[model samples]
Target: MKKMFNYYSDKYLASWIIKFLDLIVVFVGFVLASLLRFNFEVAGMSLSKLLEQSLITCAVYLVIFSLSKTSDLVMRHTSFTDIHGIFKAVVFSLAILIGMDVFLYEGMDYTGVFLIPKSILIIQALLVMLGISGYRLAAKSIYATFLNSSSALKSNVLIVGADVSSLMTKSTLLNSSKHSIRVIGHVDNHPKLQGKKLDGSPVFQLDNVINSSFLKEKGIDEIIISDATLGPAQKRAVIDSALQYNIKVREVPPHEKWVNGELTENQIKPVRIEDLLGRSEIKLDSINIQNELQGKTVLVTGGAGSIGSEIVRQALFFKPKKVIALDQGETPCYELGNTLKKLPEDIAAKCEIVIADITHFRRMQQIFSKYKPDLVFHAAAYKHVPLMENNASEAVETNVFGTKNIADLALRYKVQKFVMVSTDKAINPTNVMGASKRVAEIYVQALNSQQNSTHYIVTRFGNVLGSNGSVIPLFQKQIEKGGPITITHKDITRYFMTISEACNLVLEAGSIGNGGEIFVFDMGESVKILDLAKKMIQLSGLQEGKDIDIEFVGLRPGEKLYEELLAVEENTLSTHHPKIMRAQIQPVVSDEVKVLMDRLHEKVLHGDDEGVVGGLKQLVPEYISKNSVYSRLDKKSSQAYA
Candidate 1:
């Protein structure tokens, strides 16, 4: 019994001990085979007669097992390769046994004396294979059970699904001896899997799993979700319930993120805010987008920025003739080049990164003159609200003057479509950044005409989760620093989308637009910043106010408590796509928009920020400043209106 159970150790059983055990099994198997072959006629097979043949059989198998190194593998971790080793040993031993059984010693007159008779050798071979495999399998199963029940230090983790993925995750965690984790059970709602036993653990329903008191009973320290098909909403629900129960929850990393293309225990991590966005996958009108961009030379201003870079990446898939990644930042432009080079050589070669400023008319004109782009995506602007509030003139220079240059050049060069990347903040603007973008939106929307060859389109969206300087990254860094995660206000809320999803809709909306359309994306439900901060803390495996803290910093200049996607007088009409809509708002004419842009441009040229703010109010009458010095301009404009 000790020989049988000694295989359940931290290290592998000794090869010599393994050989001794295998020979013992071979000797016993031959005796059992002799009884079965002779119909249990033990009188003919006396112990004295069997002893000599059993020793010879054990010696032959011992030699075969040594030569094949069949005992070199860990019995408790036996795989098919180890089983194959046993098969080779069995066949080689059988070859020697058959030779001895058939050999006729004519000189000694022993032709009838068969050593370990032919019938017994055949029966023993069948018995040996079954016994060897059964021994290893029993060892493996017992070792697993021993590890599950014997270790008081091991953590008990409950798996969140009963699928193939969950099985793999369970095997990975259980096999990692360093982690010392025992999977308590699986939680899933599939009707077929319910009440089923996986690795001797129950597969229970996920409905009210946290409330079931099963976790407390089992002393489950963590919950691991490994189901790939589980929707984001379902995942968030599980995570939320687990957090409330003080049960740490982690998700198995996607297969692609596995290190060296193999899953490991360390790779599993807590689900991030990005994972819970629950954003539906955006299905693109790829054929329509291809028809619009195929063989067309495209220009993406601010191509190094978040949204601009993503558009460039997606647009290349449509087989554009050439894509010009125009941005002023030399470093980002170089980085973008390196990124583009990772694509197929053909697509990478079709891309060119130009270091140029959109605000400089001569530079942009030179680009427009040389490439004569058929389509342009303008993503460059001063987007930081607080920073722009302090530097209103600079925002006007880039957002206003830069936009005018791109629109005029697109019109002059007869570009098919010009898509301007706008923000939801542009609607009913309350900040200099939003007002500047609104001014640009007015300019671009005004430039589109019935007879004009160029069609100006605007795609407006809310915050993208992983964009540079976005809230999610900010909270992550703060949590990493082990400090207070700062929020402008507890009640403040914002809409969010993934960077890829936002850019996909941009491409989709650009393909389907005619001209003079401000397209708004369906940015799903808003998220409260305070709640977002708390979740980030929990995901970091830290308790709020104990391991970390959430600091409510007052709202910054020009920051609003709530974000709006459409203005008070404006509503959206659905397009062919469910997520995209055309804003039904009054469009300004070119002549009128040109006059206000000229005044804003003159103020920008004179470095008169106040005059620029005043001009912006005149351009967008609904522009109301909030918690900003520019709020005085709202009053001034309102008085003038009165």
Candidate 2:
């Protein structure tokens, strides 16, 4: 039964057969009208005359319909436009019959030519309209039933909005022969749409929680969000409610992303954790960035890493003279080269790949002297907390010494701007990684104080979503392995920004900075790791305790429960861009910073882990070690001072 009307079995009658059926309707309508006009007294009627007149009526209807080509339309797909064509054909045929009747009134008086009465012809027109409209509607409804009942339609769904786009989305989803999903109804919070019907389905309340009974009653196993006006908070609420019932949720791509102005099944994507962050798109200070980067050669040090790579990609849009992607990772640089090959030929030619370690001052200096980059973005660093706690010397080697190497060479080569990417952990340092970054920041700021040739800028932001070794990917792997998801602490919270947004703001900060300024990005709200774990479990269609367990391990070495964007002693001054802020810090003279770095480098040369970490703490007095072997150093320093 399902196959008979589905797309595979979509067959329509031949045009000749449909024309014959239409003529039969016309003949039957005329006979029925004659019978009704004569009060069913067939004996008083002239049977031979009635037969001739019915044939004439059929011929007239057929000519008009054939001329209008109404029968060529598929009955199963008949629309309002098709029905209107039939109505026009019927009225036109009626008018022609009326004209014949008027001219042959004398013949009717003689009871010889045109024997049918005008009253009978009028009634026949009404009957023809009803008959033509009824069967086409019946065919269309039957085909719809077959499609809805097909085995291909496996899931019942609710569209997210009750608007014109939602209605169009419903029709597109259901009407497409290739789609396997069925739209059960629409969901909206508009009070005006409550208790109302869209198409033949009822609009359900949006905020109501989905219970088992309601799920069974509505047969809702999925929902497709198509509403552009629905905010992130609203989307998160719906997603949470749907996941409670194990109902799958998907979202439609924005209309601008539609393929060739039409929606495709491949374009409807699954909801991602990033969308739940509820932050709007940042309005980048593009004018400032463009004016700064245009026609200038730029260099990004960690150019293959997440933040660095995004910077390279977005920078190409500003039509720079050239971009040098300098990274030590051979494989990542190669892969980035392949990806860049997919860009326009002219743009692809603008990027130059180089493999060099930033810790080597001569290698960096050589590159800077050759390319003479007008602007430089220094992003490479060791960011992991526990690993850096154990390898304090190595952290200082890359994050501090590497940064100083780049900054010193930038000054030598007369680079226009040097932007260093720093993390929020640098604000109130608890880990060796954070301490090293803070020391690097201090060195750059101090260098900026003494220099007027090259401006040194520091852009500080929090963790970026889906960066290497981030929590979200960690939980995803644990979930895939079907076991407990490990978190440091239940109350631990951290700020997050999407990688693209953070890098764009970095460019904005680089554009607006003159010299020696630390720009802090607004990281919106901090999300609780405990809540994030639960949401991930639910999103995977599993219960936390029932299907998989969530284990709260104690905090790792040098890890903190909360991350801060600003130190207590530091305050921020507003920038032209609302999302970026310039931090006001007490300045250190160039001589003092140079002395401290020289001592730190000497300790690094002697491979003294303790001495290197001790020097970093002395530089940033706020630095305090936690849950690590380095905490002993803090104890010794306090005891000696006391």
Reference-based TM-score, model 2: 0.75
lDDT (tens digit, per residue) of candidate 1 on 1-642:
444433546578788887788887898899999899889998777787788788888888888888888888777666555777798789889889888765644334464435567788888888888888889878877777666555558888999988767876886777555666877899888889888998678898888585567677778889998987777777887877777767888889876787655577788887787876656678888999999999999999999989889999999989999999999998888889889988999888888889999889999999999999999999998799999999999999999889989989998889999999999999888899999999888888777854568999999999998998899998899999998888989899999999999999999999999999999999989998888888778777889999998888899988999999999899999999999999998857778777777777888888988888888888888888999987877666433421
Q: List the residue pairs that clash in candidate 1.
A: none
Candidate 2: lDDT over CA atoms?
Answer: 0.85
- Which regions of candidate 2 fall more than 4 Å away from where they truly are? 1-144, 147-156, 162-182, 188-198, 202-220, 241-246, 256-266, 638-642
- What TM-score would you give candidate 1 relative to the actual structure? 0.81
Candidate 2 residue lDDT tens string, 1-642? 554455455577888888888888899999999999999999998888889999999989989999999899778666556778899999999999988877677645545546568899999999988898888778766666666667654678888988876765775666555655667788889999898999887898787534235655777888889898988778887787677678777788887887656575677777887778747778886787889989999999999888888899989888899999989999989889988988999988999999999998888888988999999999988999999888888889999999989998899889999999999999889999999999999989888888799999999999899998899999999999997999989999999999989988999999989998999999999999999888888777788889999998999999999999999988999989999998988877778778778888888888788888788887878999888788888777732321
Q: After superposition, how far is residue 240 of candidate 1 from its true place, in Å?
A: 1.7
> Distance (Å) between predicted and true CA of 285, model 2?
2.4
Best by lDDT: 2
Worst 10 residues of 1 by lDDT: 104-113
Residue 330 CA error for candidate 2 (Å)?
Answer: 1.6
Clashes (N, CA, C under 3 Å) per candidate? 0, 0
Look at candidate 2 and tell me the lDDT of residue 102. 72
